[model samples]
Target: MADTARRTDDLLAGLPVPGARSPGQGERAAGAKNTARAARSRFMAAHGEEVYDRLTDGRTRHLRLRELVDAAAREFPGLVPDAAQLAQESARPQADKDGREIDQGIFFSRLLGSPLAGPHLMDAMLRPTDRALRLLPDFRRTGFADLGSVTLERRGSAAHLTMCRPDCLNAEDNEQVEAMETAVDLALLDPAVHVGLLRGGEMTHPRYRGRRVFSAGINLKSLHAGRISLVDFLLRRELGYIAKLMRGVLVDHETSWQSRTIEKPWVAAVDTFAIGGGMQLLMVFDRVIAGSDAYLSLPAAQEGIVPGAGNFRLGRLAGGRISRQVVLWGRRLWASEPDARLLIDEVVDPAAVGAAADAALERLDSPAVVTNRRVLNLAEEPPEAFRAYLAEFSLQQALRLYSEDVIGKVGRFSAGCAAPPA
Candidate 1:
């Protein structure tokens, strides 16, 4: 673990900072606007000219993103692609002989794989989209890349933040998280947006088709390949995005202070499952509208990594004993389970999830949700508990990142998401 902690320092030192905006760069965003290819070209010029040549060179048609990443990995060991806005903006989608278009997903895969992209990805995900920042809420999706995956469209006083990647069971990679964080903040900042309905899109998989899976957790393929770094995982997740959720406080030896004042009511519509980090996120919601068939768990113990903020949040929501069974014993809690039921405000049929969530939102006075949540935090949230837990979770998880324990379980764990129950 000591050695692992040391490696984290050396590894992250090379990663790019996520949300920094260079004054001079906006001047460059103009030339790249013509096409994705041009955006990608200029981006590469600013970041890696050699990479640009190899990608654009006639040797490789660069059809699928996976192929590009595989080729880049083979050619440049530990090479990090420049997916900066400069690159992303200038990039134009390319199709192979098959006519399948290539998007930023390739450079994104490599960037996520590098671990350098984590901080930037995390920070970028939390900020409002540039267009969203500059323009009105009505025009948020104007030119955003991530909105295609998890869209945030305004719906009557509430912003509907839906997870749209059914193929991956709504699993979050840097891309999804970035999209989610941006969407979340958009709702938080918008004056008209009083409530948020967090939900998932229809699944197309045979076993789960037409069903909405809340989220399968972090993208496991990226995890299996070790593209996501530990600090990046802990910071963006446990301590960063998830932590900034409410007005909870972070007390220390010196002083106690509120985490972040900017907050709004978030009501998660759990149509199916909220496993792993998906379940971890539930603690921050004002209310959870789970489907009757919904299942929940924090399988970090099984996955060989300490669960993120789930440890603290779950313990707070469901009690310490139940959370321990989960964080330690890999206990799977169904919606009907006593421990699970305690946290779930309401459980309705799958078909009624939409109505139930909106109904719940309608039942509450939006401003009151925020006020009452603060009241609940005062009563339930222990001083320095979350901060202390994440401190430990991040350090130990960093160790788990390089541990044989995780490497062995990742294949089984990741594949299990799409598999039918035995």
Candidate 2:
């Protein structure tokens, strides 16, 4: 565990700082008129002419731009190809004999934004063009690169769960959701993962919701146009996968379930939005740290959808009435809401959200095992069995929670509509 903690710390140090970039780089790329020119200039400025020539020389030898950037992007996340390479890749036909040269445009487009021509530009580059080109990167088609979804970094007795999806606003499409379920299943199966923290990046996009994004729920971008058609198929697949992962976690509990190893209490602090599937993940944690902006909402209703399988889990944790109110209406509920007060233990200003979460985590009693057992027992069964449930069932409680939703909905609406539309 000591070694694991050290390694985890080192990994954090090595990972590229998110949103950290040279000034003018992002503004240029996102600019309506100068995006392409900016991307090209930025590429040259960052990679000296010497390196550019070396790359082009290598490319002439049939090296694909995707292959080169994917190698470099491991260290530099936002880097792009040179203009010369981009033009050549785009000019090469789909049936070109040289696979690497022709595919460069596809790779560059996916990493950066696809041209205004279409989002599938990047997908076409990296995948087989025959069947894959016809189907955009969605539920029906997946990336050829077998990118794993969840990353686990063992720290002392608890393993920190890193929910990584660098693209698509951290959205949980069918593939990402499957990855998260697998990570949790691993934690549950391995008694060593006594605690877990589910989290998301602050700036996630292409499927962004305003300026904020949360891991609490699924991002709408991941769902395909025909997502409704495949609900049953997706549901069955997820259930089977999640069940197996959970079974693995619970299997060895009878013995070797030592709990005193971790010196810290289990906690998951949600930074920004924790909506949709992200909120479902929060339920799996024992203690939650929420930010002022960290209101919970189920926007699926706005799109004429329900949370589906995750609904039961949420209802089990929050009182059934409160859960239904949130999901059915798809309204945002804040800390002041009567039901929200009962649902979330603490709410702090955005400035204090992180520190507050750290404080809450530091105060929990340990042996760690006892705390976890209590939480699972409290949350696992239907809320009806707990004394907490009775308090939640009161008509007075329902009115207050619902009232908060109304006040928040009317008073706290966005000042203006989103630019691209959600």
Candidate 3:
């Protein structure tokens, strides 16, 4: 571990300092840009392949991957922009798009794009988070885990994993993502549960007061506040809980060929709306039940970021044109609409959502549900394809997260000038 840490420190040290200016007069700015470019090239030449090899060496554990990231942040402060810096950057009228941390994004983009690192990264992410591991034993015994932003309660044959950020309409943030994934781990690992049900808790937001909302997607407030991290929130999310929702929990560290996973059919009950990430999640569920008055939309264009795996999976569920309409054109599909039926398995009265979910969960708890779901997943996504999509997504999303457009959009949304994407 000491040797590895030393080597890692050396590799990180080679990276260009974010705003280092070459010492001189008049031509200092241009000279700094040129110097930074040279430094980057030198680092890539010396350490790029080594970094890939290290990532795919198959010896480093998931915890070690996190340790390395933490080390990078500690050793090179601005390299991995902490939460406070991220918040500061988000609130700026014009963000520092080419800031020091942008290089960190570039590093991850290249790293994730590697054929070796791509799948390895997927494997690492699929392993349950440490928080899940810590809480699992208690949850397994009690069949109930109340993770602050989300909760897991095993009810009969179904494990109800409720997203509970009522104040934010269950919008996903790092803490929520961690909690949700941990709850998902509990649900999948519990032997008594045959089906997993996802639903949002009641909201405190005035417009949706006392009402349950499926999700408002990424917390725009958090994003505008710079509380979101490129790796921890963006990459970890799609690759972590959301992917776990589709693929299942990795139970053993065997090769992908002989891997063991604990998986169950999942049912999503959409109450008020499934916006952005919420809508993206529906693509992975085995069954979806929505209130007739509910709606769905992927406002990726409006938000100026990729809507998780929506691009890869939405087309598979709703076909090309409609997928394009929702993802690219900002089209919202109400549950009653014909197009909505493509994504929603059942649309019932708002009051009937619970009953509808119960029925779906009952049906999903059958002996063949897991087998058939696995077959369907293999036919449609296959782990390899999903892994590749996320590899590219990590890079594209990192860039977008720091882009001026996203910062501006988030700023407007934060200021209450921009309405939620319809």
Candidate 4:
């Protein structure tokens, strides 16, 4: 996001150092060389040293950082990491874990410089394959006012994303969306994570008491209060990490190029309800295990704005006609119905949904799962066609955001809420 402003090398050099050798001394060069050797030693021990040396041989090690990043882009895509996960994993090498390339993209920036840094990081982060993404250093949300809405925990070969805005039935605002986006990005990049589980905060908030509700959709209170801007909404949904993606793209891509579907399977455990934006997200989940009494609906018609990307993805799950009713006519989909059950893979007791999701994901943890997912994605939702639909959806959504109907809806929806959030 830095706009090529300052010369990074000069900036790093000009900064005052404590107890350091004088400028232009070979000491710094020796230090950098030592770092390079350490990286080589680790890579070699892990069976990738030859690949590293071949790519970096005779070249200045710092200058060669780009080649590793580019290799990850070409060969591993979304798995090329930025920071937090790598830092955590590397910090405890004595702990058992899978081996991977030097995952920190900034290692290159610190050594080679920013001009070389920015583009490679961008490219590595933007790849659509399962491994395609770069986390910010410390790897939290990028453009949000708060990060309390979503939390991530890395488990062995799994990442758990917990949505925690239970005060609004776990409703989403720009902050929540941004936080969830980073959570998903972390799961995609971490080689240790082969599965992801998403669920709600439940008893985490006082207003909800002890009840568990998956989500109430977009935070109408936030939208009405002007807490979320039209630009933030559009950019995040259209181009940011949580953009509508074809599950099939992930499933069908080569091991190297697999998109989200093939990248890592995500299981959604819906406890109470999924409405509008919340219901819409199930379209991208590899598996959905919802409570028996849970309900799903796309109430965009009532909202007077598009329900996130629900309109585009709903039809693939619930047929065009059913989707139309939910999206256009405001139909509440109950988990008990055959139609609702069609979209959700399993229906379980509300309290057991998490266990059900874990069991389902465990069954899917196989070497061929990605290939199998790709096959399903290709057969069901081709990427090209889905992208075309998104293009149209985005256009209509932009117009809807600032429309008169939406302005009226905001007033009415806000009136029905508790109060403007503190």
Candidate 5:
């Protein structure tokens, strides 16, 4: 493992950083690329394929992937650039810094794009994390689990997974991502739970005090402070709980040739608003119930980052033109608007959201709901398409995370000079 790790580090280190070279460095860049390719060939000759095959085989594949990540992290501490480093790098004027994140992103990108490892990587991602598994038994027994930034409660046939983070208006950070995935795992793993429901907890923010606000998106405050990571937060999120919500947990080490997910239908209740990442999530839900006055937006354009899966999925939900308007032009959709109807299935008064959610859950908890959902998902967005999207998304998002525009936008948002789209 140590030898494999060392060789892997050398391969990654030799790869030329994307979008970093000056205009005059084309020749040098080509030379570097050739050198990196040769290094990769050498690494493969030195047992790269054997390492991947051994690590991603059988029932313990996911655990082995975890071990590989840990080993890589230890070998190259900067392999997972923490939020602070990201923020500092973002503040720089040029997007020329060849930070470790770029290399790490390339490493994972190549891995995911590889035929031998891509399917196994997807399976590992779909499987619940060790922490989530650890908390499952307790949650299943008690029907309630509090995962710091998120909570789960089993109510009749429904497992309600609520996002908390009142201090940040339910904004997502690394901690929130972990907790949310764990809660999602619990909701799907519980045998008694036939349906899963998601909502935001009440916020303490002055504007929305004592009221549920679905999500303010990617926690700009944390991003500005440099608390998020490329792998742990960004890649883990899109591949982790978010994917789980769409495809559910993989029950075995079976190949990707067959569908064997233990998935349940999910309904999201949009209380106040769903912004950025929050809106990205609604694309995967079976049903979305929103308050009449609630709104949704994907301000990825303004934020200078790609909204997770929104680019690929939103177009299918809201049409290509509207999707471009929302993702590229930062258009906001009010729940009561006709344009919003494409995304929201039901719109109710704010006070009636609880009743409406309960009713929706009851309706969704049918014997064939999961089967129907699987059929619909397979037709609309197959697993292969999703896998390919992420293979590219991983690299694109990593580049955007450290761009100068993104840093400036985050800084302005953090300083309260810019407001979320109206």
Candidate 6:
């Protein structure tokens, strides 16, 4: 009987039980392992002592015992854990969520203590919606080593270029000019970009730092010294090249159209004297926002040279009488000139110039319309001559001659006609 009992015990130990299986038995062992893992998982999830100990510290994301209980109730159906139990388990103290703290300060006392509390409390406890703040000109990461001390930022769809080069009003060296031009061209080429804001290349005013001034002109010292200069030949070449490039963009069969895949309107706020080449670029823009502290001049005549590209274009835009005075005499026109036709559009206060540009931009809805109209009107008179020139000189021939000859002739003839008969 004892031998039989011993044999029966041996059989029970060797054979698989209801919940247990031998590890050496592959398929059965895997099933057993899975069951063991599931049981361990349930136990761990219920206690989670190891997880809590590993993850939490004194500074860990701690919630109030009551809040935890409430949250648990929300997550688990009909299972609201005890707040006191949670408080005992989790030693971390809880005051309130940051948002709730704001609400408490705003409306907690009033609600708890007043008759007017209930109705107003809900409203007061509400927080204002938060919005993402972004850097303007979106140029936060942009850095230019050769740009001297100028820093540019984005303002809406425009790139705002500011010269932070001390109060010396040092004229633009080649490095500075190249940097500015490259940066401007980069921003201009971008389809998303619209306008550029230029500021502080000059002092506001030497006597009054707040008053504002502009850089005198291209650094003549650098120019004459030949260290880095704006020589006439180089200037003419560069100017013609840039103007031609701009005309291509502005008059392209595709880009010229406002609805094209790529197109933009440009404007600049001249804070001070945009003299020489700097002033020349301003004419290329659709508009100029002249600061009250600003002055516009053409100083090539003063330098015993012609403004060339600048003078020719200015003459077209401003008419001969005014253009001659501006270029030949180098007259400094203030931003508030009531009769200044050359400036284009309105003369506004410096502070209001930005707003004015925006208002003007709103009015010019279609760049295509503007370009086409100007092209047609410029091509209207001297059609045969323009066509002949167009065959040789192309569109530029018309733009230049129309101003020099057409306007000049028309003005002379009109004056002759209006004069008293001899």
Give the top-scoring candidate (TM-score).
3
Tell me each candidate's TM-score.
Answer: 0.64, 0.46, 0.83, 0.62, 0.82, 0.46
Model 5, residue pairs in steric clash: 83-226, 83-227, 83-228, 84-226
The clash count of every prediction, one per candidate, is 14, 14, 1, 14, 4, 7
Q: Which stretches of candidate 2 lie over 4 Å from their true place?
A: 1-148, 186-192, 204-212, 225-248, 252-266, 313-321, 336-338, 359-365, 368-422
lDDT at residue 224 of model 3 (Cα atoms) = 74
Model 1, span 323-346: residue lDDT tens: 788888877788866667777888
lDDT of model 6 at residue 13?
Answer: 38
Worst 10 residues of 5 by lDDT: 91-100
Pitting candidate 3 against candidate 4, the one with the higher TM-score is 3
Better of 5 and 6 by TM-score: 5
Best by lDDT: 5
Model 4 spans with C-alpha error above 4 angstroms: 1-147, 203-207, 243-262, 416-422
TM-score of 6: 0.46
Residue 186 alpha-carbon offset, candidate 6, angstroms: 1.4
Residue pair clashes in candidate 6: 136-154, 137-153, 137-154, 137-155, 203-213, 204-212, 204-213
Give the better candidate number (3 or 5) by lDDT: 5
Judge candidate 1 at residue 392 and give its lDDT.
Answer: 46
Q: What's the residue-level lDDT of 61 in candidate 4? A: 41
Candidate numbers sorted by TM-score from highest down: 3, 5, 1, 4, 6, 2
Per-residue C-alpha lDDT of model 5 across residues 203-307, encoded as one tens digit per residue: 887777798989888988777766666777888888889989999988653433555778889999999899989998999999999999899999889889989
Q: What lDDT, from 0 to 1, does candidate 1 have? A: 0.57
lDDT of 4 by residue, 294-346 (tens): 88888888888777656666777778999888888988888989889767999
How would you encode candidate 2's per-residue C-alpha lDDT over 1-422 as one tens digit per residue? 22332333244334322134234643432242133334433553454333333544633422222344544434333333334433443353222111121122222322223122111211122222122123223311221212265565554445455555645445565566545544454444444444555555544443553433455444333222212112212332223233222222222234436531112234666666666656655554457777776676666555343353446566766778877777777767775565665556777776776567555544553555455554564457432332222222221221221232422432222222221222
Between candidates 3 and 4, the lDDT winner = 3
* Candidate 3 weakest ten by summed lDDT: 17-26
